[model samples]
Structures are given as structure tokens and as C-alpha cells.
Target: MTKESMMLPARTYSVSIDRDWRALYEEIWQPEYFTKWASGLAESDLRADGDGWLADGPEGPIRIRFTPHNDYGVMDHFVDADTGSEVHIPLRVVQNGDGAEVMLTLYRQPGMSDEKFAADAKWINGDLKALKALFTPQRGRNG
Candidate 1:
């Protein structure tokens, strides 16, 4: 048996949504939404290769394809270009009475670094915050 040289660290982050979290996620989590929310976005849908999806930001391009789960959730299978490994990012929705909660979890390979973990955390935190701000109605704001 051979030891793995490089491995990605596991990371997870979540936030509450103003609307139905599952529905909003299913509707909004896409390349278009990333371009709208994420900085320095570059994305495309390559149809020649079975509708492969690509999105790039400050953390480099994350090539992935999405699949909807039966339990009102979704999964992003990240294609590791370097090591040919796959990383799974799972998202779920939790009902919170009038609104909902969005949970995002990132599962990385073993031996991921502190720097990478921190970066991923910061990005997800900020992204969720921004998303909530955009969807949530502010006090005294017009309908």
C-alpha cells in the first residue's frame, strides 16, 4: 500500500435563509448566482462534454457538477484536476418557521492544511452573510 501525498482538509459552514432554504438553494445555487455574489467570477457550461460546469473565483477555478438529492438537497462533486480526487460539498435546508436555514458542508480529503481550511471558512462565512443580507428584508424597507 502507498501513502497519499496530497489531501484536502474538511470544512463546513452554514447560515439562515429568509425564504425556503431548500427551494432557494435549488433555485439560486448555480454559476449565475456565483457570478452575482462571488468576486472575480468566470464560468461556463461546456455542453460538448455532457454539460460540465466550471466556476472560478479568488480561490481558483472549481470545476464541478451538481446533483439534486431526493431529500430536498443538493451535492456538488468537485473534480480535482491535479490529483484526480473528488471532493463533496453537501448542502441541506432546515425549516425555521417563517423562514429557513441553509447548511453547507465541505468534505475534504485527509491532510488538508490550516491555511486552506481558514480560507475556505472565511469564504463560506462571507458568502452566506452576503446571501442572507440580499434576501432578508431590512427594517422599514419597502416591500
Candidate 2:
């Protein structure tokens, strides 16, 4: 593929969180917070590696680079698979009335089987739900 090429067969998944977008983004930036809700994205612990992160993916060890912290609530990340292929994962937290909407875009990579893509989509949906649950309030015993 040429440089700056865009992948096709993309899907965008989103979840609604009952919290301020900025605050949610800040909480997500905290160390270990991501792993709590993104277990499907990284199967093993993620360790700091200079400006990027290293994780033991299901296939093998992989490197990830995240977008720098900013005021715009962007948390885009790129993953480099052990097979020498790189995939861009677009993520964002945006305001939705009094709540926040988190969106993640998944691109169907070249040679990716349909079954694998469907599984990834389901995993992404579950991960997003887990993220929303973090900001959801729990019911007390009285309830």
C-alpha cells in the first residue's frame, strides 16, 4: 500500500457515557485505566516504552503509539503487529448534551478474514460498553 493510504470496509462503534467528555477523557488517560476497559484490545499488560507502549498481543508482542494528550478529547492510537503490519485505530470522546459519546473506528485490513472482522467488531462493541460502565453509577443496596 502507498503512504497515507486509507483502508476500506470500516466500521464505527460508539457508546454513551453519562459524564463530561473532558472529565471522562482525563480519567481514561490515567495509567491502568485503559486496560481496565480495553481488555479485548490488549490481552497482556502494557508497559511503557519511551513514547509508545508495548503489549503482548494474542498473536505476539506488539507496539502501540497513542495520540498525545490534548484538550480536544482525542485518543487515537496505532498498533504495529508482530507481522510487520500497522493499523490505525481512531478513537474520540465528544460531548453529547450532558453526557459523552465515545467513538471508535475499525478498519478492515487487507487480507483480514470476514470472520475475524466480525469478531473484532463484537469485541470493540463490548469494550466500548465496558468503558461506559466505568462512568455509570452503581445502585445501592436499598435499590
Candidate 3:
């Protein structure tokens, strides 16, 4: 098996949004918004006695569980291609002047290759660019 197929790796990405932390966190970190960011990124309804749930991501079904982070003013959770592990993800939102910064840190499965790592980083950067555009004001003629 390839390195990526055997272990989890840790990765971090940050985004600066032109909005308050609380409002930005609430508005952008929802099931609907996730879906809009990428096709099929919606939360699934959980039935009683359910062990796990899925997020319909564009790539495929991404397994997830909703976790709360009170002080950060946002709900967070773990998401992966599998759900039968002890893996849990923690996300945070920080206030940065009138704008907000969001940091996403994920512990990817170990044994992941350098190429895979590079690809993941590139994907995250692209995603953040899209996210910033979504929240930032468009350039208008001022001068």
C-alpha cells in the first residue's frame, strides 16, 4: 500500500475573511454553505442509535460527526473517507480586527507521500482563495 493509504498526516490552512469571527463562522460553516463551496457537501440526517453520518462531498461520501467548540463561536467536527476510527478534528475561528481568520488543521492518515502532501496543500490554498473571494468585497473604482 502507498504511504497515504496507511497513516494519517497533519495539515493546516488559514483563511482571512472580511467579517467578524462569529458572523463569518456561523454563516460559512453550515451544511448548506459547505454544499455550495463544493458540490454534494451536505450533512446527512442522523437517526437514533446511529453510529455515524456522512457529508455528501463532490468527490464522494465523506464521513463526519458534528463537534462543538463553544469559545470559538463555531461548530466543528471530524470528516474522512472512513468513520470507524478514533479520529476527531478540531477547528477554530479567531478575531482579526474587522476581519476574521479561520484555521483548519487536519491530521491526515500517516504514510502519506510527499506528492500527496503537496497536492493537499495546493488544494487547500485554492480552496482558501475561493473562500476569501466569497467573503471579501469586490474591488470597485475608488480612485
- State which candidate has the highest lDDT: 2
> What would the per-residue lDDT of candidate 3 be over residues 47-125, giving only the tens digit for each residue?
2224445655555556766654355655466666554554465566789898798776666556667886787677666
Q: Tally clashing residue pairs in candidate 2.
A: 0
TM-scores, all models, native as reference: 0.67, 0.88, 0.69
The runs of at least 3 residues in candidate 3 whose Cα sits more than 4 Å from the true structure, single-residue gaps closed, are 1-9, 38-53, 140-143
Per-residue lDDT, model 3, residue 137, is 69
Q: Tens digits of per-residue lDDT for model 2 on 1-143? A: 77557547899999999898898899896535678889644457889999888887767788888988899988998899766767899999999998899999999988889999999999899999888877788899998
On the 0 to 100 scale, the lDDT of residue 115 in model 2 is: 98
lDDT: worst 10-residue window of model 1: 40-49
- Give the TM-score ranking, best first: 2, 3, 1
lDDT of 1 by residue, 7-51 (tens): 444556778777876677666655456555444342432221355
How many clashes show up per model? Answer: 0, 0, 12
Candidate 1: stretches off by over 4 Å: 1-11, 29-31, 38-49, 69-71, 79-82, 138-143
Ranking by lDDT: 2, 3, 1
